[model samples]
Target chain A: MAYTVEGKGPSHIGIRMSNDAPPSHKEEARAQAEEALFGFWVFLMSDLIIFSMLFATYATMTHALAGGPGPKQLFDIHSAALETIALLLSSFTCGLATLYMRYDGSVKKTLLWFVVTLLLGAVFLSLELHDFIAMAAKGGVPSRSGWLSASWALIGTHGLHVTTGCIWLLIMFAQVAKFGLDPLVQTRFMRLALFWHFLDVVWIGIFSIVYLLGVIS
Target chain B: MSADPRRERRQELHGYIAGLCLALILSAIPFAAVMTGALPRAGIVWTIAIAALCQVMVHFRLFLHIDLSRSHRDDLQLILFSLLIVVLMVGGTLWVLGNQRAMMG
Candidate 1:
């Protein structure tokens, strides 16, 4: 039988066909995972466009402080650095979870790493919220100026994504407990892993462009 | 799939750790440069931008496993295309608005 260039077969789930028995079982799971991953990648790219627009807006309005507080007055680089580290470490842990799932096929190890990732994500979110609250308390709220408005919109959107990701992580825990590491559950986990890493990448952009450059300027 | 599963696992572990280390260092250097005033303002901005771009590539290759390699070309192409759109939109907005600001001034 000839294989498609994309390696996806005729089934809606795109199950791969093979001659070998045991490996074919793995291939069956991989096929479903690949389809899910492709769909999720398209979603991520759209999400990327949204973030890029937000960043562009923030950049344009950076100078529109309206005589209000600026980044030098509001941004605490120490806290931002801490949050960055937390998110980056969480991404690493999420990658490790997927690796464990792929190699050892141990649901326990995968869940453990995922739990660690969730905690790190929570820490990052709390730090971000604390920053927002502190800024608001100082009259640096979104209504203060265009600069503040754009900054809040950009950073807040990212925070909302992290919040959704945390909720998804909880749902994953429940799914694993209920369904184990079946093909469907594994595909969900893989998509969540992509999402978690994608968030980290966005954060890097925010930190460098919004925080670091803001402080310097 | 690998002929030696143990070796493959080891290699995977190393990749994650190396990515983590590089990401940390890349993140820290920009912050340190900014905080310490180790460079001029323009230089610091450039450093942060470059570091962020590099770290993004590292995450793509190591964490997301998206690369230029044959196995991942489709996803890589998708990402590159998205990046092109982003650059056009963002860079265009900034350039136009910046010029408007200058004209207004």
Candidate 2:
């Protein structure tokens, strides 16, 4: 029942366990882990800058409809809300996965939560794709208008990131299965959690500035 | 940060639940404002903006485990710096473009 996972072989892989190593070794490992996590945060902030630029572009193009359909005609609030919920739930489940991995050290519970998170992420992407299809059916294609182009660029970028995250989640699942809860695996999972949660943060901006404001304004 | 793992896990769980609840509420308000059409256009706009800002804060505080505590100072600084860049870039873009549109009109 000890949460500390000892390496199974003579390879000394377990020496880097973040929590259970001898005192000085534990401090060094924890410091390294924190440094790596901080580096990941910096990367997330850079990604934020990219999203902000896209947002600025979308904002400027809102009025350049070029006689094509506008947000009001193209956006369905119900579907957007559903997508928001799916993503939010996925983020919450991701948090749960981290909790299981770090706190309970229960591989079974951690994997279960991650599986749920992946499913929710999939649901969010499907709903987004459906929305795009619906918009195109209504002549809301990016080629039809500057506004549509900007909208597609902004929303499409976020969607692409989510797709990448889903793939990463699957790969992490495989790693977790193969490596168990090694510190390196845990560190990678932490980065993935940060990425996933950061995506939800960006979605806040998207739903608010893009979808909600688009329909309302 | 508590010494007890059980207590720490409980605290983290509470944080996540709180974040999710607040986010859901923040999201619902803007959507409701728009869907119900019960507010003035300006009011709906304000609601959406304010709710979004608050939700973003909630995500950082609760889900990301960021705060003004000394240990989190570095993260807070990084985030603030990023926010400054975003404001400069996004605000400048809007101002310049809006001026151009005004002149063309």
Top-scoring candidate (DockQ)? 2
Q: Which numbered prediction scores highest in TM-score against the true structure?
A: 2
Kindly list the per-residue Cα lDDT of model 1 for residues A1-217, writing each as its tens digit.
3322346532323222212236645566555657568889999999999999999999899899999999998999999999999999999999899888766778889999999999999999999999999889888999999999999999999999999999999998988887676545666788899999999999999999889989888
Give per-residue lDDT, candidate 1, residue A169: 94
lDDT of 1 by residue, B1-105 (tens): 456767978887999999999999999999999989979888888889899989998998888889676656778888989999999999999999999988995
Model 2, A29-54: lDDT tens digits are 66667777888999999999999999
- Over 4 Å off in model 2, which ranges? A1-19
Q: Could you tell me which 10 consecutive residues in candidate 1 chain A have the lowest summed lDDT?
A: A11-20
Question: Could you tell me the interface RMSD of model 1?
Answer: 1.0
TM-score of chain B of each: 0.89, 0.94
Residue lDDT tens for model 2, B40-104: 99999999999999999999999998998876788889999999999999999999999999999
